[model samples]
Target chain A: MSHVSSSPKVRGGRKAAVGNVGRPPVAWALPGILFFALFAIVPLAIAVYLSFCHWDGLNSPTSAGTANWTRLFKDPEFRQAAWLSLLLTTISWVFQTPVALLLGVWAAGRQRSRAVLSAIFFVPLLLSTTAIAMLFHALLDPNFGVIKEIGPWFGIDPNIMGSSTGALLTVAFVGGWQFMPFHTLIYQGGTRQIPQVLYQAAEIDGAGMFRQFFHITLPQLRNTITTSSVLMIVGSLTYFDTVLIMTKGGPGTDTTILPYLMYRTGFQTYDLGYAAAIATALVVVATAISLILVRFSGFGNMRSTREGM
Target chain B: MSIDTRPVTRPARPLNRTRPAGAARRRRWGNPLAGLGSLVWLVLVIVPLYTLVSSSLMHQDEALNGDPLAFPTNPTLENYRTVLDSGFFTMLSNTAIVAVATTAIVLVLSIPVAYVAVRTRSRLSGLAFRTFLLGVAIPAQAVIVPLYLLISKMGLYDSLPAIILPTAAFAMPVAVLILSGTMRDVSEEMYEAMALDGASPLRMLWQLAIPMSKAGISTVAIYTALQAWNGFLFPLILTQSEENRVLTLGLFNFMSQFGVNIPAILAAIVLSVVPIFAVYLVARKALVNGLMGVGGK
Candidate 1:
């Protein structure tokens, strides 16, 4: 009786309590921890060290102390990328949040009618970054692209993703476009989770669609709404693929955001030290943004809830 | 892009007062506006695809100046044949090996780790959990130079393994994050019964964790494949020879060699996109369901 109960109970409890207080490692947890440590942790530490020294990403190495960091602090390109990242992040967050909310609310009440359209729009998100870039690339081509093809009609002969103002705006728009499915999905999930009975009660109170969103839907989806914003914020800072494939920070470096600059510094210039410093700054920015959003949304409390798991 | 600007409220028609008056109006009102809005977006996404495929079929003359919206005047498979015959097979195989190998490693490495992150209870496990999050934040571009150096020094540059390892490393965090969420949903009662039946911990994980998280695992697997196959940076920076080119770099190579054979390029893209798109079509619901959770929290 004693042997039978204790071993099973303790094992079960440990399984239920992964990463929790005062418990043993579960059966499979050990190997998981090892792979992550070897692949994730070691490489990260090595990267941080490599950032401080002049290695050329080849040869032996020489220490640079704070020289790399200091150079990054004063570099014009670095400043531009940082500034651009901030601008894009602000624009995406401010714009996408409201539009996403509106789309989410609009889609909720009309399911069957929106089904085919949902699939069409959803295609972009499921696709390769290669494809999305290609679609816009063809459309935005300076000579005879679709947008250019149609631009004269609107009397707008602008380089939508080629000019500086257009570059960030286009990036923001692309970012917004690919990500709207995610927002719609989360809102769909969260709103569905809100019991139908509640909506019936709200209708009896003469609540309209707009009021329903603010009073019922928004409050209910507070968790997801905040999560979507935080994810977008982080994503905008780390936006790389679109910039790489389309702009390459081109049209005379007009679209150089932080990740693009890091790519340029590290790969193009072989400045390992400076690249690392830039990478560190990016990490700092990403972490700070996450923490800020977490603090604002109270997701940090998830640590406490996670403890219960 | 038309928006359905339907009236949010009606003149307080008494509930159940007029069956035909309200019911008839409601159906007519929402359907067309909703249908019209979606059509605009549908055309937005579909037109390029239509052009891309149609352009490949048309001769160069018809391609550059023909009606952009019309079906190909003389649809042809020559472009498809061009890509398939012109060392395209090698590039296709190269892409397959890199993408398939990366997917295998990520699945093998992350599944056990995800299970641990869900089932273990240790400070070290907690450290590992947070460590995976680093894979997400560190823009891989930051480490490309060192990675290139590292791969090149190890005599792996231009080798398929060079791209495979780094891609898997970058993707592992998200994979684990997704898998752990799926694994956590597997109840402890199920695991307890297995332990009671004298199953080893290894067996328990195989039977319980892996089996339960199948949907989540597959979704993550498909996504990882898509990411690796479409990876442009690694193969671009690491590979040097035409022999080493994956599909993505192959496109760039074709661009350099014979100019952007837009028809051939589009045909190749069509080929590349269809397999993954087919995979998505089959698994669309599972993917969306998985992402709602994965992205939500």
Candidate 2:
């Protein structure tokens, strides 16, 4: 019943169908296979290879052995960027998850309010990251930005991005704001996959909303939570557009994260090898986290339903 | 919490029934906690946007001198005119071409792999599936260097093709994963019947898969379009000229160029957002459902 595949055993029938259909000569898949190989697989290999060499996008690459790799660990900027990214990931989980879940549950259950609230929330998600960045950037500016003025009214610094702590938190907050709707949708859709019977059963048992949420909703959303967590972490690890637009890893590198760091290094500094090394580290870290979650989290175990959609 | 006094009235039907009256009554009674939560959510999302839009319309002096939160008293389209007159249209066109081309290419390329992966079920198709799944984990930032180099080596450097080709490449992972998942939703018997009709895979793909997976296809198209439209790094690193700029890069350049012209910049940002927002409105459901496919499966 999972919307993903309907049944896992569909594969058995697929295999039988393949036998009768002659499996459409493998050549039929050439164009797609070639595209992936050249673009995805090959580029990954090239990145790995280039990570071990020094190149500046001009001359031939010279073998640098572990020079670039070693330098990444030694470089304080690299370390800071990596740390900030990790912090962003942590903040996303702490802030976005519960908030999105709350709004999502509320939206999913209600009728009239759901449409109104969803449209409001989903506006950010619809706007391009650049637009979101510009919107926040304008609002966060000290001189003319509106949020700065509001900050004084509320006794909080409107120019939060000016301070190191505020910059990091603000960046994380903006990132969360733009994406919370996305996570909210996942949760809303996930809430749908939860059968009404469960809530009805809880109601029949004289369970309160809190009790039902604790005993039913939380457990049922396990896979979804795992999936969004992985997404959030990986998203944080590789987040570039907002940071690039907002801070440019600025205010003394307070907001620098791995992807932006890699970008600045490669594009601005033309340290292709060093950037590739950072890129390799980012991919390794992201892939490792994702693999670990998938392995340990029972990520595919939401029974009788589709996964993400 | 106060106990509900309403009598519970379960539906005669078993599963998938609406909430009983008592439960609905309890929900309708409204939880203050939920109300507070909703109010907070609304403020968080709507306020910043209002600020952006309002400021975009304000005069520069007014924006700088007036209360930032106030709506524009002397609203003007001067900022928008400034933006449009400054080659914003060219950048927009470039962005449109990139987005459209990328989405078209991704759809053209992903459909076959999706069909093959689902119907062939061969080792190679499985490999194709795994390869695509692997690409999902490989962030574009990781391979961007090679992509840059490859695009340059192909003599596509500093051009729309440089951005378009790579954007399409990166989009394939999510696009393929989504399409294949939706394709798998096609019942085995459907494929069997197509095979019994002696349909070539291409015919089945064109006639059946495309029609049946229309929702998934639109989702892929929208996502790919979104990626291309919102693309920054590619356009930033690959294309360098004013003529080659897309909206994301264009907006960046426009902001810095008109630095401190907050209204003009905000107006430009608002203008840059209109097309994508329109697209999102049109395809909102597919976008949501498609995203769910990613998270759900």
Each prediction's RMSD to truth: 7.0, 5.2
lDDT of 1 by residue, A1-309 (tens): 233333322333544433233223454555645654554455556667877899776568698888888888898989988999999899988977876665554454434456445556666675556556655665566553456566566776646765788777887877777677767666655554554544556766766645655676677677767667776787778668788777888778888898888888777888777877787788778877776776777643222122222
lDDT of 1 at A10: 30
lDDT of 2 by residue, B42-109 (tens): 89888888888998899999998898889899999999999999998899899999999999989988
User: Could you give the DockQ of candidate 1?
Assistant: 0.26
- Report, for all candidates in order, the number of backbone clashes: 3, 13
CA shift of B86, model 2, Å: 0.6
lDDT of 2 by residue, A166-207 (tens): 888888898899889888877876766676766677878888
